[model samples]
Target: MDFSFPKNERIKSKKLMEAIFTEGKNLNNFPLKLIYLPSDFDDDTQFKVAVVAPKRNFKKAVDRNRIKRLMREAYRLNKGVIFNNSERDFALVFLYLGKEMPDFQLMESKMTGLLEKFLKKIANEEAV
Candidate 1:
């Protein structure tokens, strides 16, 4: 499968962002947190996501931006877990919650675990 993170697959709408935070369910793995909301969107992409690094934890813009970049790369590589397994659209937010910086390997592994947990939860819910 193509592993490109096109702009259309990224979240940019203020309304959608607010809806994600207000109506979404969260799955967390320490430094990474995923908040996901099932929704209908005009785009054909199965998921539209945003990555955020809080300024409170990372005081410098450079630090926050680096964290966001790492989060995005990890998500881009690992998002197929949801894309291939599910048949619905979701607005997802990936939040960086740690006070310290993390390497890409750590980020990617945790992201994979978080997505797996999400799949299990969704499967259980649907089965029930």
Candidate 2:
């Protein structure tokens, strides 16, 4: 499976971002919160993702950027789970709730769990 995170998968729209925060349903896994909305997209990508590291929690821009980068990496690696199972498009935002910095291992593991749960929810399948 392809593991690349291409430019098209990034969520860059202001309106969609607002809609995600306002009306999307959320799934939480500790420091990682997955806010997902089923929507049609012009692109062929199965889902569009945005990563958020709150400025209030992370005061330094460097810290915030680092957290966002880590989250994106985690998502990129694990996103195949979502892509292979879903028949429709979605808008997803990953909101990091940790006040402190996290290692890549932690981020990736949390991302994996969050994604597994998301897949279960979407498929309406019994947990494995």
Query: What local distance difference test score does each model get?
Result: 0.89, 0.91
Per-residue lDDT of candidate 2, residues 1-128 (tens digit)? 79998889889999999999899988999899999998899878889999999998989999999999999999989888888887878999999998889999999999999999998898773333
Clashes of 2: 0
Q: After superposition, how far is residue 32 of candidate 2 from its true place, in Å?
A: 0.4
Runs off by more than 4 Å, candidate 1: none
Q: How much lDDT does candidate 2 score?
A: 0.91
Off by over 4 Å in 2: 125-128
The digit string of per-residue lDDT tens for model 1 on 1-128 reads 67889999999899999998988999999988989998898868888989999988889999999998998888888877888898878788999888899999999999999989888878887789
TM-score of 1: 0.96
Q: Work out the TM-score per prediction.
A: 0.96, 0.94
Clashes per candidate, residues 3 or more apart or on different chains: 0, 0
Deviation of model 2 at 21, angstroms: 0.9
